[model samples]
Target: MQNSATIASDFAELPATASRGPLRIEYRWINDAAADTRADTRIAVFLHEGLGSIAMWRDWPQALCERLGMRGLVYSRPGYGLSTPRAHGVKWPVDFMAHQACDVLPALLDALDIDMPARQRTWLIGHSDGGSIALLYAARHAGALAGAVTIAPHVFVEDISVQSIAQTKQLYETTDLRNKLGRYHADVDSAFYGWNDIWLNPAFRQWSIVGELAAIREPLLAIQGHDDNYGTMAQIDTIAQHVPHARLVKLDACGHSPHRDVPDKLNDAIAAFIASQT
Candidate 1:
């Protein structure tokens, strides 16, 4: 396999056939390596957190892809980055994450012409809300993925999560959180309000994907921080209980984001796990 020198960036507009009306996605191709190696390579698709966008991931995805000598596809979900924003006054439903996994993500891959079942099955690396989306996708389309890695994923909404979200709403209104977040998003309001409004919705409190976990037949690596304020060890533990071959890792001194808090350890663990699987 030829190893390239740098990452490449591109965008794809979903076609009418994808059923996702006029959506444009911003994506990055990291560690392109070489054209000759494309056929045999397994691509890692990185999905960002709730408020995260392509730029928000910064250099982490590229760093990991380089470490593994793997190519990676990192994209911003609609409404999060330079991608299409949610229409004004529109609200996401309780099963928004499912919609993302089953519809948006598939449409994106299709738009990019990356066939998942045609010897191009991907390795999904997702964080927080993205992690939950990864789990849903793996369960619904088991054969499309080689494996899944979730960091700080939430299978069920917790009271602490709600409380933290409430505080974030306050920060958005009172502090400079909006301005700070604006650097990473094209439409700051669309990203923050869309995520904040949904989680804080009363009906969302009952949202749970516990039943869906059992259907995830692919190997899983569930990582979470012992000190995470948004979720607890139960999140990863429950996943392990259902996914027979699942592995769990709890990082000490790391809060919600192990990638950011302890990237070296996180990358080592992920690279080793992916290598073992292959």
Candidate 2:
């Protein structure tokens, strides 16, 4: 028996649903032509941040897919978006992000039927926690990957990361944060605490995948903001140290989320990297 999420391409600018393992996943393909036989058609899978879903990504994936002329896939992981919410008593494990990378992502890809040239041309574009997941997936499945790009990814836990998340936890409780996030999730608490709790857990302070990055043979680009609120440049710097061939892009006047803060620059860098890699 295998664990996987199942969905086909050819969606009409709308999201679709599928089931992965015991969880139902909400996913959608962008600008995909089911019958297009162009040799250069590519696939870029977008992995959102810890508290992000397909809706939270807004039109960024569509914009990037158009910019790079590649098919794109976006999804909400378990306990996110319109997918099944986390059970009331269930708590995510310390290795939640790693499980997302090693287990959930692979299963989703298999179910999406990415066993074509897209498999070889596939690129993972991840942000924040998603960036870390992208790195782990590339390390574990380099042979099936073409390239990867990470934005503000955490290779290791940092004091500042914990501080900011803890602060946001307060916001989620005291402010309209939950109301704002509610627009993107079916169960805001499930989406919020599922990510928040594990990240702030004492056991997670030691969570780091820096050692496994050595196995990533695929072309990789790591991006970070000069003024990121979460992790520091050490995150991407460590990535460069581990994967010597990985390209590093440091953006000035940017914060944690580059796609939102500096979309033009991020898009250009992504387009250039993919062009150069291809």
Candidate 3:
């Protein structure tokens, strides 16, 4: 196994073989120290939050991959970062997360030539909406996944989520949140409204993947912050009930994003969990 010292970045174009049409995905690969000892088979994929892009993830994926000595992939979804923007007047559906989990993510892996065999050694590390997507994908594609680590994931809609989302929509209109997020997105509105609009939709309140999570059979680690404003302990707690083998960790004083709030502790916990599984 060769350990490199460079981070590779590029774009993968998906031909319109699926219903979502053609898309360009911007991705970054952190390969420095990727193949440590006999751990070359291990691969980590980082999925960002609802409004996150490759730029927004910054260096946390790289930091975690360095800690584990594994190759890591981080990418922007269709309507985020430098990837294709949402078409004008297109409103996201209530099941947008499902479409992302079922369609977009699989296509991305395929386009990158990550076959099912390789997926057996792949770990999906996701946060917020991305965390939910990771669970949804693992629910149906357990055979293709080694395991999953969800940070502040939601299995069901809650009143708290609605309130936060509503506040965010207001911030986007009345404040400089749009300009600030523009630093990470080529089309800020595409990334923001696409996620914000869907979450605030009245129909989305009924969207729940709690029942679907029972399909996940791989090792799972569910982590959440004790003081998260968007969702509460019920999120990760529900995951533990369905996935009896899932390990749970609640970080005190940590908010919605544990990686940002407590990077060192989070990294150690994840590395230990993966080591124990192996």
Candidate 4:
């Protein structure tokens, strides 16, 4: 486990356009150190949390890419990071995560010229809400990916998640949380409120992805922290039950964000998993 986190690297955004929507999206590219010397390695796509952005991933993605000799693409969703913000007063629906996986991500990938079945298929590494999106995408587009790694993914909404989010909402309003998060997002309010409202909405309590996970045929690695405030072991347990080929890792003293809390262990586990699959 790492004692401290690395500083986030500065990232530049390239506008990615697609027909499904998100006229413009934000993305960054990290070339492998040996790109000039070796053939391209597999592509690793890093999807941030509901409230996360490309910058929030800090140096973690680059570190992982360096270890595996893989090329990396880290991007911010429409309402986070330097990406486009959500329209005013628009609350994400219960199926919002689904939309992100099934529509938004594919379009963004296309815009980036990452065509599947032609060029190298990408591997997905997602955190928190991003993890859930990864699952959905793998389920829907199993043939398009090499594998997936989900850190602190949610298969279903839990009371603990709702409660913790409520606390974050309070903190955002009362503390410096907003000011701090603002540094990572273009529109901090849009990023925070967009994620917070949907999770807290009464209708969202029944949202679940357990049924959809069975369709995913790609090898998957589900990781979670034992002390994660937002979810429990049941999340990954359910994933294992649904995706028979899935692997699970539970870390002690780690929180919701394993990439941040136990980076060394998380990176090692991820590298091993990817190696086993490749």
Question: Which candidate comes out best when scored by lDDT?
Answer: 3
User: Which pairs of residues collide in candidate 1?
Assistant: 4-33
TM-score: model 2 vs. ground truth: 0.91
lDDT by residue (127-197, candidate 2, tens digit) is 99999999998998868888999999999999999999999999999999999999988899989999998
In candidate 3, stretches whose alpha carbon ends up further than 4 angstroms from where it belongs are: 1-8, 35-39
Q: If the candidates were sorted by their TM-score against the true structure, best first, what order would they fall in? A: 3, 1, 4, 2
lDDT of 4 by residue, 1-278 (tens): 12113323343333444633434677777754535555545788998998999878878888888887887888888889877788768889899998889878877787776776523357899999999999999998868898899999999999999999999999999999999999888899999999999999999999999999999888899999999999999999999999999999999899998888889999999999988986
Task: Name the 10 consecutive residues with the lowest summed lDDT in model 4.
Answer: 1-10
Give the better candidate number (1 or 3) by lDDT.
Answer: 3
The lDDT of model 3 is 0.88
Q: TM-scores, in order shown?
A: 0.94, 0.91, 0.94, 0.91
| True-structure Cα RMSD, model 4 | 3.4
What lDDT is reached at residue 236 by model 3?
93
lDDT of 2: 0.85
Sum up the clashes in candidate 4.
0
Question: Highest TM-score among the candidates is held by which one?
Answer: 3
* Candidate 3, position 145, lDDT: 87
